[model samples]
Target: MKIRCSTFLNCHLLLFRLYFLSLLVFTFATTPEEDPSVIVSRFQKYLQINTAQPHPNYYEAADFILSQANSLSLHSQTLEFVEGKPTLLLKWPGSNPNLPSILLNSHTDVVPSEPHKWAHPPFDAHLDPNGDIYARGSQDMKCVGMQYLEAIRRLKASGFQPIRTVYLSFVPDEEIGGHDGAEKFADSDIFNKMNVGIVVDEGLASPNENYRVFYAERCPWWLVIKATGAPGHGAKLYDNTAMENLLKSIESVRRFRAAQFDLVKAGLKAEGEVTSVNMVFLKAGTPSPTGFVMNLQPSEAEAGFDIRVPPTADQESLEKRIAEEWAPASRNMTFTFKQKVSVHDKFGKPILTAADSSNPWWTLLEGAVKKANGKLGKPEIFPASTDARYFRKRGLPAIGFSPMANTPILLHDHNEFLNQAEYLKGIDMYESIIKAYASYVEHTRDGASREEL
Candidate 1:
């Protein structure tokens, strides 16, 4: 009787052990903890969401981001300064709340993608055998947004706590200009309450092994020039015809554009250092059933130009030139500017962040990248505008950075993609960066902190 009782207990014990072992195997096979695959999976999931502009599903994206925050035990909230456009914020509170916080900002909305032009469906987030994840926001920004959250997850799992709070902001409408998104938020009481010190925003990808950083960005100026004059037969040569006046203005603009392009082509200046003007549209003549009237010259003609000006450029001089040479009113031409971003802060200071050691934040950032085994290229002005300008205009230090080395600049381009390896490496890079920034407690002279400087 004793032997039978012992045998029954031993058999049940063996059966329980087998069941536990199988459970462990299944867990490992299905869910990985702190694995690169898991990180990539999260990134791909975000890329799958269609947040392309003109009609972005902001609520869905907000819900997805909030879910991630909940998984990480982060404090999350959504604020819509403009109805239907939601801005998401996640916070990892630090031990010391008095210290100024670090803000990592990324936009949810991406430029529209041409689905038929892509090798894979732009919203599919397809990962090929070579480990390239192709999608609409693969490079432009969604990658950065996911990287920020994943880095925080790893930090939390490792029992790491920061001295200063770190905030992740996923705002909308950046691709179409942040008027309803960051622009409003930056000026809101909520942003002021965050006590943000330094903001890190989006930057273009690098074509080489060194990552590119932007200290400033070129401001965009969308210009439309209209000319009105006497209408006449197409064959008749008139002194002040609308088309002729518009053509003269175009020639002036072309000359200026060529000069800027030549400087860049000759390597005398970086593309962002000089003014860039491109003719985007030209409208003239009277439309008919099939085409414009060929025999009669229309009295009015208009041309639109997309112009980018560097902060260091003379804005007043450029405007004067526009009024005189490019679209002189004496020539029956009038011009208007739209979406002209200011190149200076409210205090009249240039919208630029110091990249050298004079700024302690820059020093910390440089050291952090080095610790991650990454190299930074010489800081340059961003060739295009980004949401960073909004923060910079408020006299805050903003850095434009995207950790994508040895990759093509494919933002808003067809077949856009980011290799899984690079994407994983970026997460690692952000982990180090967040740690350095959050742990820093240095204070500068004049009672200002390292971030305030």
Candidate 2:
């Protein structure tokens, strides 16, 4: 026998209520206990602050950085080239003021998060029973910034003084582009005055035991290809309609993307070694109050793509290929570049920090990591861009390292977290690296101390 309609409706309503109740429980059930470690408490406090894009609370974040700097007895300054965007700089001056300084940089702003998708409030900085502290910026880099300061605090407490100056830079607008953050700071007189020699920025975590490092990053190219042709009625088949040419160009670009992906799948290329092209959006058709006009064909259509090219690829050659194939003039197609490439110097060499033995910075960084009981994997070009590129372009050796091993890579993902123990361990590793770099003796003369030489 079939159930009555009223009974079926009542049952469905009951099921819906139960599902919602369970969801609420799952989202807010885990309440974390208070952490005793000063560093852990500070990390939690930082995650509670909102510095995400579009409208980050820059002043409040700067206050936090300033407090940490003052407590550690480090001199600090907050600089803003573009009105509200502030980049905080903290300095620990060494005995030798003339020596090139060490810069440890981290972006303050984080990406947006969806609270409904999280196990805890994304901004609460909740530490669960298992020691995982959940928050939005737990890994995308507030964690590293805190580690840098805490490491210095501990070192100074133990009566250690560096031979060279060390600077901690907390910047903004990295999620969009560094136009307002690092890009401006890198070009500023304050940065040049520091005479930066070696730099360290955030890197991705390693799921395995080995840590990941980056010496280069893929270049991002945002393009829009527009096609123009004769406009006519929808009934007749035209020789070269706007949509037809646009589709042809899209297909051509897709084929190139497929070939690049094939190389990755065949193990001949890593994901960072190949080009990635993806369609972001398309614009066409005339709009009526209800919808697009179906009876008439439009004269213009355009498609947008976000492409990333590896440094190994020749930039000039790729531009020529795009002009020849993707948006050829013979096909009545033209393209616009939303962003351009300029990661090279007057000498025509790509702006990449050498990871080999020839570079003294690289050798020193490798030694520091090993001394911390960390194993670093072979350096790879960062699959995405970072502010480190700005320093490398300025001829300074900037290494991308996060010191997070045996952890999952969860940047910008829902339920992002960092293990409390792991967070503390990162401070220790940073301590080793900072001490090594600050007291480094590149080539001291006989009987000459690091500071004297």
Best-matching candidate per lDDT? 1
> What RMSD, rounded to one decimal, does every model reach?
7.4, 19.7
Candidate 2 per-residue lDDT over residues 1-453, each given as its tens digit:
256888899999999999999989866754343244766999888888899878888899999889989988899998999999999999999888677788999999999999999999999999999999999999999999999998898788667899989999999999998889999999999998987878899898889888899888888899999999999998989978899999998999999999999999999988888888999999999899999999888999999999888778888887887898888988898999898656574345676777887766677788988898888998988888899988877766778998788889999999999999888878888998999889986643343322221
Task: Give all candidates' CA lDDT scores.
Answer: 0.90, 0.86
| Cα RMSD for predicted model 1 | 7.4
Runs in model 2 deviating more than 4 A are 1-36, 443-453
Instruction: Give the TM-scores of the predictions, in the order they appear.
Output: 0.91, 0.88
Predicted structure with the largest TM-score when compared to the true one: 1
Model 1, TM vs. native: 0.91
Task: Output the lDDT of residue 65, model 1.
Answer: 96
Question: What residue pairs are clashing in model 2?
Answer: none
Cα lDDT tens digits, model 1, 148-267, are 998888888767899999999999999888999999989999999998888999888998999898989999999999999989998888898999999999999999999999999999
